[model samples]
Target: MSLVKVESSEGITTITMARPEKRNALTQELCDGLYDAYRAFEAGDDQVAVLQADGPAFCVGADLMAPPAAMWKAVPHVSHALTKPVIAATQGWVIGGGICLVMTCDLMVSADTTKFMYPEAKVGVFGGLMPGIVSRMPHKVAMELLLLGEEISVKRAYDVGFVNKVVPLGEERAEARRMATVIAQSAPLVIRTLRDFANQTLPRGPAEIFVPERYKLETIANSADRKEGAAAFREKRPAQFKGR
Candidate 1:
């Protein structure tokens, strides 16, 4: 079964994370699924997208025990740039990379019961992908969550302009759909032009700016040639790289 579920109607596309059992943890397959879904959405006739997740939590970030091969792929504009806008509808806890995902979206709707947190500092690991949060919300507030690793309540998130709408616990997705429908009715060319212009005006973080470069390095780092090079260095011999 696919971890990501996609549905389209009335020029609106709904992309959902469907890993309720694990609170939609970003596994390798799930990341790939999300990338593929967004890429398809970009190419399809859909004019707007609503991103939501199944289960109590929107997402719990990476599965530390079995992290994705390329978590960045799941990020908007990083791997799959979309001309159309995406709105996130979140509930429960959104942490770490989950926060990254929501922050990248053009707009967001949070459940009244939701809590946003970035615990990478407490977990003793960091992805450095969340610096873009500073561009989305207040610099100091973003830093507080990034550095102190504390939870931000839904109300505070709204006050800080992180959330566009705050609905009841189970109404996040509905609100997102309503917003998406409105956007879908707008002129596509103008919407695309505005989205493109807005993206260009925003300051990109290192992760967003160098995603392609990082992808190349990641490819080389995971290649057999890298292992062979290391072995050859240790053995004082020339490396035999097949460019695999």
Candidate 2:
């Protein structure tokens, strides 16, 4: 059976990690499957994506027992380039590469029982994907997770702004899907435009912030979805955007 499952309905694509016996640990095949699944979602007509796992634990990190080369090649870094919104529904252990995966998502809904950790240091390895976590969190908090390699409670994760919402254990996936549905109802073109703009601007240093907002403005101004949105508001009806 496939380690990763991709299912689509309406405008949402759901990607599930399915390695429960091993706590959904990242194996070479699983990593490749995840990368391919994300790529498929990005290229497909899905306007939003929900990433979740089908086990007690979301992911326990990389399969350290696997060959080093396989492990290295299996990291799902492709998630970083997705243009559409990607929401993570996390529960139980989210460690090592699992933490990296959470950082890559546009939003994350973590279970109250979830425990985030970066135990790479404990295992004599450094988190190569620490940049992803550092980019999203404060420097001190990032250092704590990286240097100390301890488990972080879900409440602390939300407090530090790494997690968007903290839901009861079994409710995480439902809440994530609800959020994804809300996003899916929006104008797809505008959603992609906004995501693109944020991706381009938010990670850059002040000295590197040279891109002008006028480009996005022009794109929005010329989009049919924009005009439809205005018309719908004027008519007091919901906009029916065809992603034009």
Candidate 3:
């Protein structure tokens, strides 16, 4: 049976980690399945994607018994490459790679009972996905997570802007789907363009923003959807965007 199960409908693709027997630990097969699922969403017609897990824990990080090479192959960073929005609905333990997965997503809706941690230091290895945490949060917070390897409360994650929302346990997926449905109602092309632009610009320093950034913005501004948006507003009607 597949470790990852993907279901798509109404422009949203839901990918679920399906290894509840082991608390959804990251194994080689599971990694490959997840990678494929994300890539499929990027290429498919889905306007949004949701990453969720089945069982008590979102993930327990890598299955230590799995081969190192296989573990490396399962990098969850691919989710960040998606132009469409990806939401993570997490609960229980979001540890190690689980935290990495949360960090990589465009948005996160975690359970109030969720606990995030990085236990790599305890295992005598650096967290390979530490960059994900550092990129999303302040250096001090990131360092603390990395060095201490202690569980970070959901409230703390929300306070740090790491999580977009915190819901009651078991409501995470439902809430995520609601958010996805709202986002899916918007013009797909505009959503993609906005996400692409933000991803490109948000991480850059003022000195780094230059001709390339301006050029991208100009391209989006001139897109057919942009014109349609303005015309629709003037007509006082919903715009029909074709993702141009």
lDDT of 1: 0.90
- Those runs of model 1 whose alpha carbons end farther than 4 Å from true positions after fitting are 216-244
Best by TM-score: 1
Q: List the residue pairs that clash in candidate 2.
A: none
**Candidate 1 Cα deviation (angstroms), residue 109:** 0.7
Instruction: Quantify all predictions' global Cα lDDT against the true fold.
Output: 0.90, 0.79, 0.80
Residue 19 error, candidate 2, Å: 0.4
lDDT digits (tens) for residues 186-232 of candidate 3:
99889889888877755632312342355357668999999999999
- The whole-model C-alpha lDDT of candidate 2 against the native structure comes to 0.79
**lDDT at 104, model 3:** 61
TM-score of every candidate: 0.87, 0.79, 0.79
- Name the lDDT value of residue 82 in candidate 2: 66
**lDDT of model 2 at position 22:** 94
TM-score of 3: 0.79
User: By TM-score, how accurate is candidate 1?
Assistant: 0.87
Please give, for residues 1-244, the per-residue lDDT of candidate 1 as tens digits: 9999999999999999999999988999999999999989999999999999999999999999888868988887677878899999999999889998888899999999789999998988777689989888999999999999999999999999999999998889888999998899999999999999988988878878788687778889999999999999999999999998
